[model samples]
Target: MTTAKNDINKRIQELTKALETKSARLNDISNTVIDETGKGHMVISTEAHADYQKTLGEAREIKSLIEEQKAHLDIERFPRRAERAQLCGPGRRPDRARQAVQVPV
Candidate 1:
């Protein structure tokens, strides 16, 4: 279970990094270009536009995956937390030894 949680955390980090990279690329693509005349123009070729859209879509997908991983991590923690609570709840004595019953002949 710890391994699984680690894997999920790694996946979330990977997805988050991918999403950030895609978003940065999208920002670069959308940035206005300054021409020699000091004029700023947002000129995006159809191919570039398409690429931007594709990258945006991929970023959204990665975001969704990150959310899923987070939810999964939460779920993974819930059982451990519940078990701990059950063991250490009020009036609970986990360290106590059970008494043995004596049998009458």
Candidate 2:
């Protein structure tokens, strides 16, 4: 039973790692698309443009898969409930991790 649990944990970790990697790759591809679109000259060869579009499509698909996997993991980890932010209001932002709001009387 313990071995099975450990295996499950390992699989989860692997999935998490893959999701992170794919997310980063997706970001890179998106940035590339943005950069290419920003270029003033539309001088890219037809073949190159086609390749870029293909890469962009693949990146989008991979990103979707990563998100699906992430959602599945979230459900596995928090089966009964979603995150506080998801279930409630805006909730805490990481940028304001330790800051507290002050109120005056």
Candidate 3:
């Protein structure tokens, strides 16, 4: 369980870093300007705009992956009570003292 938790955390970190890089690239692309000769106005090219959109999409995907990793980490850190009970087997309780009680007839 510890190893699994560690792996999930590592994956989340990796995804977060990737998202950051993609965001940075998107910002750079958005700020890019194309110089059109004889026209004093700075404008972005179609290709640069497309690149920004693609990077933005990638960043969104990475953000989703990070969220999934966080969910996995949460599960690993705090397993559901029902799952723990299941591990005790059928007709068995988690508390041994409760299991030792005798029913009065």
Rank the candidate models, highest TM-score first.
Answer: 1, 3, 2
Q: Tens digit of lDDT per residue, candidate 2, span 6-60?
A: 5555665765676566556656544444344666643555665666677567656
TM-score, candidate number 1: 0.69
Candidate 1: C-alpha RMSD after superposition: 6.9
Residue pairs that clash (backbone atoms under 3 angstroms), model 3? none
TM-score, every prediction: 0.69, 0.42, 0.64
lDDT of 3 by residue, 1-105 (tens): 577878888888888889889988987996787666758677888899889888888898999888888877776767655665666666777676345455577
Q: Candidate 1 on 85-104: residue-level lDDT in tens? A: 56566555545312222246
Point out where model 3 deviates above 4 Å: 33-42, 80-105
Residue runs of model 1 more than 4 Å from their true location after superposition: 32-43, 88-105
The 10-residue segment with the lowest total lDDT in model 1: 94-103
Report, for every candidate in turn, its global Cα lDDT versus the true structure.
Answer: 0.78, 0.56, 0.78
Steric collisions counted per model: 0, 0, 0
